[model samples]
Target: MQTQKSFEATTQGILYLVPTPIGNLEDMTFRAIRLLKEADRIAAEDTRNTQKLLNHFEIQTSQISFHEHNSKERTPFLVEKLLSGETIAQVSDAGMPSISDPGVDLVKAAIEAGITVVPLPGANAALPALIASGISPQPFYFHGFLPRKKKDLNAELETLNKRQETIIFYESPHRLKALLDQIEKVMGPERKIVLARELTKRYEEFIRGTISEVSEWAQNEQIRGEFCVILEGNANPVSENETAEWQNWTIKEHVEQVMDTEEMSSKQAIKEVSQRRSQPKRDIYAAYHEI
Candidate 1:
């Protein structure tokens, strides 16, 4: 009887941040299972999705539907349970919660409310794609997902193109080809890119080559699954012939000349010159005294 009391007291409720498998079910960690089973309540992004996983593991812990649509209303109630000493676990449909998902807001609220929040270590696609991408993982930037608008996407890619460390972007299967084409147009066709698709799954594939090559390949194949595009940093700048007629002009004039010759818009011309010169857009604009 004393031991049972001790166990109950020790089980004071806490919020557990559980990580689900991104692709393969085998990737789920044992600790995650133990915590999920032990928790008094589980908040799942999608009850149906979590039910499938729970059924496989035979975890019968009570679960509540918590997602973007209901997060605003649900978080307060979950926090109340934690405060009342009811241990709760939160899991996304896949991967870690709040990472390109809805779990982050809940975690933030829990922290602000002085509740204990625990994160379980497990599968993540970003790190794997970066490490296997054959690019410097350190000092790299992970742009969760690109903007859908063409101009917005190009602008974002332009900024990343100037970064010294590798850049990783999450892309959907349907948009992979279009994204690659934009990368080629805004950054350059010769830029190196690594496409990691269906990671850890049976059909996992890594297509590494110049942006143009990968773009062409994706165009011809039946693309499926989520994609992580890892791009190599810009190459070193090259010195152009200073005496050339186009070399000595102001940055704006040079940009205008390229726009005229290539029949590209001002934005496209700016992007091209910046990539070729291995300089940031702001610096290029400053050099031409446009800014």
Candidate 2:
């Protein structure tokens, strides 16, 4: 039972989760610059990469290396600094710290030590790519990266295909083609998908089409930049096996089953049942009401 009053005064120093621009340097927020300047120390994923950002903004604050390779060794040291009333600002090479980055471990340690952790929202890649993907913006599942192994990847895709919400995934340029091919195999070639790359940069591009079209495009074109893949949700999620069982049931019984299983209204269930059974809506409605 922990409550965080962000603005309240506390004896312990605060931990700030800062977000850096993904590509465009101008996307850096004024508050982020100020925090970097004011924080006692900056914990960066890569000090060299982050140094360029600091130099561009003319921020001379010192930075300590804090990335996946060293997070285990650094988390305790950062927590100790926070315990000693030294403000710590954590930043990744780009975008938000913990999203596909290693800032989460430090955050957990800070929280356990009773230090206030404040997150500053500035820039991120997932939301930007999602809104522009021409897919349903609401009810989206942000999957940062998929499993690399073939068996694990197939298993993951099988589960992800069942979701009704639009799915988002991050992929490197080198593996993009193989991933699309695998998706085509599991989800079929007709599924609509969008691929956005070089986000926020000058060469930012989006390829929107069916999985087959996109996969074909990837085969010949020079692939570059990290990709944000937006896959359309399953529109007709009811499996063929479910439809097979519908043949044995009465129209009214089918409507009731769809209503209960899909959690849809009677009107919606009737419409769905009519489409699945290849019958008129009026017929389904009449059968449902015993009219």
Residue 139's lDDT in candidate 1:
82
Q: Per-residue lDDT of 1-291 in model 1, one digit per residue for the tens?
A: 111221233434678899999889999999999999999999999999999999999999999999999999999999888888899999999998888888988888877776777788898889999999887788888778999999999898777766777888899999988998888876766667999989989988899987778989999999888998899876433234532665677678878877898898877777667667544565676765555
| Candidate 2 lDDT by residue in tens digits, 103-222 | 999999998989999999989888999999999988999998999999999999878877789999999999999999888777766667999999999999999998789999999998
Per-model C-alpha lDDT, please? 0.82, 0.90
Best by TM-score: 2
Candidate maximizing lDDT: 2
Q: What ranges in model 1 sit over 4 Å off?
A: 1-12, 235-274, 277-291
Q: Candidate 1 at 188: error in angstroms?
A: 1.1
Worst lDDT 10-window in candidate 2: 272-281
TM-score (C-alpha, index-matched) for candidate 1: 0.79
